[model samples]
Target: MNNPPSGGAGPDLSVTIAGIRFRNPVIAASGTFGYGREYQGLLDVSALGGICTKGLTLRPRPGNTGNRIHETPSGILNSIGLENPGIPAFLEKELPALRELGPVVIANLSGADPEEYAEGARILGASSIDMIELNISCPNVKAGGMAFGLDPEMAASVVGPVRRAAGGKPLMVKLSPNAPDLAAVARACVDAGADALSLVNTFKAMAIDIYRRKPVFDMVSAGLSGPAIRPIALRMVWELGNALELPLIGVGGIAGPEDALEFLLAGAAAVQVGSATFAHPAAMLETIRGIRDYMEKGAFLTVGELSIRQKSPRARDRSGNTGSPPQGG
Candidate 1:
């Protein structure tokens, strides 16, 4: 892993999360990158922590009809509606091909209801996938009536069966910032059966075409992602870190090594790079390189060393003092 590519010198970037070993802390966020194979020609995908495939459903979905993706100032709004090729096709075809790719494979599953979620977990758990990320929350589709993530009770209830079906494979629940009380819901998920957690899927946002005087998305609202959501996500990740003993994977608006470091300091076991992948196909590789560079300069030996938390300068400044001097090089 010491070989240098177009990115930077790859250091000892390995880290273990929920007992799953990853070559690096940077994972390719789901939806942004297709089932890990799409970028085979770009760079080495295996160098990443893991490849999280697009959200999967029980059956194939045609997805939304019009204007599924729209670019925003600092981010992107999407209403892809969990479009997937269905689990059966994934098991028969995609899974085999993805295995040949390097790095760990994390299967992200979404279902119309609790039963489907349990079934998907049962099948995937028995497969070669390294982990299962339950989509208890996604903000794009309003037509589903309920996302199963908004209510702590519903989210908590769904995990037990999925955990049983998972057959001991690590189960990480994706969290929604749209929840009325995010921390409460997170606690519920942990108590129910989650081994780890990934969070801040996307904020519920909407756009307007002034000329048409109508919503830009056919679904009326879409999931907002990118650098725009990083601050809020950092806060939430910190809050969760304070409230739970479980590993947390931070997502939302992480565009560079600095952002990833912020999440780590706030207590994220690891962080995922999402919208940035759309702008730079090799972004994950670059992020891995950047993290290595930062770590080397700081004389950190591993990702666990990256979790050192510094006192907030804002709080100190408010109390009439400068912040703590920057520690890392």
Candidate 2:
């Protein structure tokens, strides 16, 4: 995967998330990428830096009934509730095929309790998988989703056991933006020994069906994602980046390379292509190329050279201090 193009058009797009390195910052978000085999027919899977598998659980889950997804203005609302074939099935069927892609395979695991998380983590940890993303922020699930992610204690409990189970393999705790103070939860995960963090998972939202005189989905609430949530995700990334020194993966509402750049500028070491993947299967690849183009145009040497801080006149005071600009100068 490191075979670069002939000319040195720009710096390599490959970036490191946690301690594991990726070919590029473009990763197919969990739930959207399925098992990574489906896209094999459409594009080269090896071209991607990583693939985050659908949210897995200790036991198989059928997810919710009725309409699981709905389209909105500039986004989509999903109440899929994390339906998956369980970790055992994923390892048995999905793992072998994904291994052939020659990129990092990040298993996204969710649980109703800490023990369940540990069990899933241990099972996947023993495998050839590159990492495990603890999805504690599925807003659609009633018991084990965003609830566990909202409380710092619960988040730590869930991540701590998984970290132990991972036993040195990278463990990334995916956080919810709906939480009052995402930084607090991020700090807790860091304290619990998480290798890295992915922030602004998804925000809880709803859509009504006027013609049907009821809610669009059976669950009445869904996780909102896509361009609409970019600002929220950016703010969370900035907050968490400032609060903790740990590597961050920004996820919410990233559609193109510019959006990815915003997250990087907000302190994300890398980013995941989530809902945008649903609309454009080639989105991740395009994002990778776009970032490369951006770097070359800006005369940047590496993704690491991009600062997270906003570069504005207001950012500098009259005395050129790093603090806020002088008042009414």
Candidate 3:
């Protein structure tokens, strides 16, 4: 299983996104997998399709204070506040070792302003990382703390500058589910030069501390993720798939192979496993093997063949509509 199964021995689990090849479609979501080294002794990190590094900012952050995580029904609420070692430290300390792990490396960059994002993208573009995932969930300091991903215009303002600064490297914008018009934001990003998109970053949710009669997190609201959000996340991927031509990486509450298959069938080129890893360290590897088993049983030669659209393209788009020529993976 270390090497992709030989021809005729098994189904091909490989997928290509933004021209970068992956051994399989299961990638470790950012923030959950750290810098890829933390899970080295836990599972075969190289078996993954890719690794999205922990969120990086223009400078080191102390992160949020007080209780930062709380458990809820079927999910977890987190307010980690993007604590990271910044770009310079990642380039000097983490990346060399991460690159050796074999999986494609994606730097998950976030910032408080357009210039900050552009500067980070410029630095990362000049480095050896394989791709850059823009985490647009960071609150826009100049916009009175509204997340840049919340509005189409705001999302484009930052994406345009970062796209230019990214120096043409594969750029994927991580979309927030909290947006009033997710389709509009996706369109804006594509128009602003994004090569690919990974969606439903995290739903804006909250939890209560009943005993204290207050919010469980210091920020009052935190991100909700886990099996709880999988259904909504899958619907989002399907909707976007019908409406757009670019590749999408579906993420939200994927916990197992069954969950991963749902995203693939819904039209995601790849899938990311997040909180599930904390409980099951080998969840991603299990998902990869599970998908391979599924494909083999179904006699599917490629992951794309698993899409529902392949079976009934018109079913997905009632208007018989499509947009742009497909690009990226």
Q: Could you give candidate 3's per-residue lDDT for residues 266-299 as a string of tens digits? A: 8888999999999998888888888888887787
Candidate 2 residue spans exceeding 4 A from truth: 1-9, 310-329
Give all candidates' CA lDDT scores: 0.81, 0.82, 0.83
- lDDT minimum window of 10 residues, candidate 1: 316-325
Worst 10 residues of 3 by lDDT: 318-327
Task: List the RMSD of every prediction in angstroms.
Answer: 6.2, 6.1, 4.8
Task: Point out the worst 10-residue segment of candidate 2 by lDDT.
Answer: 320-329
For candidate 2, lDDT tens digit of each residue in 1-329?
Answer: 13222245557676766668787777889989898888877776788889999999989999999998899998999999889999999889889999898779999999998999998999989999998999999999977889889989989988889899878778888999888778888889889988788887878999999999999989899999989999988888887766666678889889888999888767677899989988787778778878887777776665655654544434421112232211210
TM-scores, all models, native as reference = 0.90, 0.90, 0.91
Clashes of 1: 2
| Candidate that scores best on lDDT | 3
